[model samples]
Structure formats: C-alpha cells, structure tokens
Target: MWIQEVGEYSKKLLDKGTGEDVVTYRRVQGGEGTKSSQQRIQVNGDGTVTIPKKDADLNISIDNGEHSNYFKNEVRGGNADIVEFDVPKWFDDFLKENTIPQSGYNSNPLNQGGTAPKLVDPTKPGNSFEVPAPWVEWIEEYAKNAQIKK
Candidate 1:
C-alpha cells in the first residue's frame, strides 16, 4: 500500500501592489518516511501564474465542469512546454485590404488580353488552375517590400 501525507503549507505575499503571491506545499511519502518541500504555486508581476510541471497534484479542465474528460491522457509523454505569440493588429487589416479574390484572379491573367489555356475535370467540383510565373514574381516582390519598415 502507498500513502501520501500533506504536511504544513505556507503562503507568502510577494508584490502586494501587483497582487503577487507564492504558495508552498510540503509532501511526505515513501515506505518508511521521506519529506520534500515543493513550490506549489507562484503569482508573477504580470499576472501570470507559474506551477511545477512534475510531481504536482493538479486538476485542469476546459470549462470547469464536473463531468469533464481527463486532459492528462492527451499529454502522451511529449514536450509539455507552452508557448505564447503576438501578432500586430495592423497585419490583419492590411491583408483584408490588399489580397485579391479568386474571382478577380480568374478574370485577369499575366498575359493580359491573350487567350489562356484551360482544362476541365469531371471529377473535380470547381475550376482548378495555377497562377502564371509573372504574377508569382510580382507577388514575391510585393511581399519583400511590404515586410520592410521605413
């Protein structure tokens, strides 16, 4: 039989202005008796909380419901690091204003006013085609210039 005893716990206030704090939990285990102290929780200055990734008793769910599915099984013993990324709001506005629709591309071709080749496939649902090399070169040039900041 295995046994786990939760010993004395302590909570200390870190940055009172930012409402940051840290909680430590003492756990005792093993056949005879072994004592170990772990920093169970930490509140950062930026409002982000940090917790031990291993040997920590935690229960997490998507929406905080009682009948929620177990999320620990989804780990599959892979990398557990969580990453965060930021995107400028202007990028979305620029794409919406600059991008050409599929219909617009079909109407205009690189060879402008010249007859373009077409292929019909009965199995496919809609017209499938590739853009001309001239258009691709122009797009690449535009992307290169757009990424540069003045």
Candidate 2:
C-alpha cells in the first residue's frame, strides 16, 4: 500500500508584533517510517518570506501563479494547485499594483496577460497547491498581506 504523511496546521489571528493573521503549517517528510523535521516560515510586511531550514525571502508569487495556471494547461501530474477564493481586498490590490504591464507589441490581438492566472479571488472554490504545508509561507503572505492594511 502507498501512503503519505502530512503535518498539522493552525491559524493565529494576531502576530506578536505585527498583529497580522498568520497561518502556521507543519510539513512531514515522506512515508510513515521516514524521519521528518519541522520548519517554520514567516512572511514579513516587507514582501519577503523566510523559512528557517530553507532559503529566506522566498517570494513564490510566481510559484503560486504557475500552480494556479495548472488547470488551464494540465501538464503537471497531480490535480490543479489551490487558488485562493477567499482573497482579502488589500491582497487583491497589491496584485493589481504589481501587475506586469505589457509595454511592447500588442498591435495584433493575440498577446495578452501572462501565463499565470490573474491574481484575484477565484469565482469558484479552487486549490492553490496540492501540498499546503510546503507552501505555508505563501499562505501567510497572502493572509497577512491582506490584513496588513497598507
């Protein structure tokens, strides 16, 4: 039989100093017999994500964007990644602020938005990624940034 192990997750309404809502997630390694290490990730108000055991300042906006586009293409093996339907208003605004403008070209009617899905709340319930634990930073970034209230 094939099985995978997963860690637990919890959401905190207020951070110690920032008082932003944070989602803390624990991730498991492999299978039942495999040894696992717990990692903590935090998203700063500065738009940088830090993972203790992994690299710090991982802004996976692109990663989340790519995963969000999985269904439109389906090249990836597993199901489509999770798309945030409960996106907060400010987070939506941030995405709007960061829109990579299409400067050149455009005479034809073919070129348009980038491959990644537009950063916005999905019309229907959607998945961002299959494994949420590894993407804890993104979750918190999206969550905290939404509540940060520029």
Per-residue lDDT for 122 in model 1?
17
Model 2 RMSD vs true structure = 14.0
In order, candidate lDDTs are 0.24, 0.29
- Compared with the true structure, what per-residue lDDT tens digits does model 2 show for residues 23-63? 32221111122222122434455544344543322222222
TM-score winner among the candidates?
Answer: 2
| Decoy 2 TM-score against native | 0.25
Please list the residue runs of candidate 2 whose C-alpha ends up more than 4 Å from where it truly belongs after superposition. Answer: 1-73, 79-85, 102-139, 142-150
Writing each residue's lDDT as its tens digit, candidate 1 over 1-150 gives 000000011122243344434221111111111222222223344433444342222221111111111111132112222111111223222222332323344575532432222221213322222223332232222221011000
Q: After superposition, how far is residue 117 of candidate 1 from its true place, in Å?
A: 23
